[model samples]
Target: MFHLLLVIIYLAFISLGLPDGLLGAAWPSMYQEFQVPVSYAGIISMIIAGGTIVSSLQSDRLTLRFGPGRVTAVSVAMTAAALFGFSVTRSFLPLCFWAVPYGLGAGSVDAALNNYVALHYASRHMSWLHCMWGVGASAGPYIMGYVLSGGGIWNTGYRCIGLLQIALTAILFLSLPLWRDRPGNGRDSATRQEEGGGAGDPAPAVPLSLMQIIAIPGAREVMVTFFCYCALEQTAGLWAASYLALHEGVSTEAAAFFASLFFIGITAGRAASGFLTLRFNDTQMIRLGLALILAGILIFFLPLGGNAALAGLIIIGLGCAPVYPCVIHSTPALFGADRSQAIIGVQMASAYVGTCLMPPLFGLLANHISISLFPFYLFVILVLMFLMHERLLKKTRR
Candidate 1:
């Protein structure tokens, strides 16, 4: 059972990362295929956010009524089908239609898995679960780039990813015998006070209500910090490769290598963080992660050229490395276990705003100015995040 759980987790994390890496790698190709403006491209990139936001309205009740495994498997299936449909569509309208279902799948899996994990597993496992997402996300681009480079059609790359999603769904289906609907004690919900879980204990739960979750003791700050953190992470991710290609004049393959470095760095950092959190306070780690990200974004935007800038991107990746897992792991700990899912739902939905906001903002900026100006946007957001971090959950950290 334990080994099977590890396999499911590894596969699930790969699904999380698939879209993350694919978006950046496929951005240029999508632009060329759709012949859309950068603004539209940015909007398209974030359309899933809108879908996830809407579906979050029902995630809790849905999970409560149906078991997490069933919900998770169904959602993963939806995401896979959506991605498959998205890969084949020649028109934008149908593509938009597909985004809605994809978002629903995204929202559902997000809520179900986090809640199930927190309710059943250790806090440290929560870190590992999300880190799996980073790993999958990091690897996705390479896979996409490989297909494209090997003379495969662009849509074929997406289909390959869809197949990967199907594989993950299959694992969940096959593992149903082992997954518990009600998390065993000290595992998922055990740490929640209402569930006989202790307060202030580490473990993430599925977020329930967006409106209500934000009202919790330190949730607002976590959201704000997450907003800042996501904006920086997403912006750097979605646009950095374009900056390298369009501005630096690197080839598509070379540019992907650069972006892969960032994701790879993130994956490496997340993997280490899962282990690190077992012995440390997450807040302290968050602070350190934020500082590293701040410096990395600054380095990415600096006037330097050649190997120095490349090194800067690596540094930036290292900086961003721990911030996400640290913040995500902090959710259930901050909100308590039972309400953790609700709070995380709110956090994830609200968190999408960052993903939605920056890509378009960067797109608009890029349309008006140089891609060099692109890094400036993230750099500015990084500063705000740095300043905002202290304000985020200020009272709670004390």
Candidate 2:
């Protein structure tokens, strides 16, 4: 049953990634057809991220009320609806309107599933489940690329993916029973305890109010760590191609293609990280990831050969791969399992906010100063993330 559940979660993650990659792939065609400036995409993205933030923060409440299975079902359905709306829309305004549900749906599922896996599954599963997400993220662009290559409209790509999401939503709804059932045990919390050789009941620590959860020690620090790390990750991802093209003198097309290595590295690295968890704990894994990220950033800034920038981006992706999964997996252990849901919800919200805000902020700085400073911005965020995570760990341990 656990394995089955994992499979469903993996599929859900792929659905999440499908829409995510679509926008970037379709935006060029979209802007041309809609007669909007490329910068207008930012407004749609910000609206989506805003919706994600709102939904992620409220994920705990929704999951508690509807259960993860139903929430997952409904969320994906909402996203599918939003995508279908995008498929037929003629103007930028309608796209922005649909993005609200798109982001909301994605955020809720992300928070709920991360918390669920952290509580019920092993650390290795956390690593691998995220790898599945990487696969989905990569697949989205390919789907869009295929559509564009075949002379199909961007709306066709959106519609096809929306249909896929609808299919996944049906599966999720059917699998609702699996989420409700605990194999060979008591309730979900009891199952968690039994699987871990009795960590004791975690019921009391869960279902916390927002204020009460924030009052817990290390909560704010954890949120800050998420914000910084996500900022670093998204900023690097959004700008790596431009940075390579501008600074390393790489061709624009080559730079765009090479930037994908960051995500590929992340996916492949997670496959390896699942094995590493056997030898290292979550905290050690995160620290190692941070070290690698710092090294990658340093490589980015170095005056190496033409291929150096590509290598740096790949390395950064690899470094980023483990940190997110490890940090999420540690939530049940760092805070009580009872509070894991609430904490994870808020953490997801912070992550979205960072993802939404930092990339634009960096773009603004690049507009004013130099795009060459991208590496430096990432370095500062990485350093701050490390410090914040360490501080949070200390408080948790105390």
Off by over 4 Å in 2: 181-207
lDDT of each: 0.71, 0.86
Error of 2 at 239 (Å): 1.2
- TM-score of every candidate relative to the true structure: 0.80, 0.92
Return the TM-score for candidate 1, rounded to 2 decimals: 0.80
- Model 1 lDDT tens row, 83-154: 899789886678778888888888878866776675556556766777788767657777889998998866
Give the worst 10-residue stretch by lDDT in candidate 1.
186-195
22 Cα displacement, candidate 1 (Å) = 3.9
lDDT by residue for model 2 over 154-266, one digit each (tens)?
99999999999999999998887678524432235523432342445455124567788789899999998899989988898889999889988999999988887887888
> How much is 286 displaced in model 2, in angstroms?
0.5
> How does residue 380 of candidate 1 score in lDDT?
78
Prediction RMSDs, each to the true structure? 5.4, 4.1
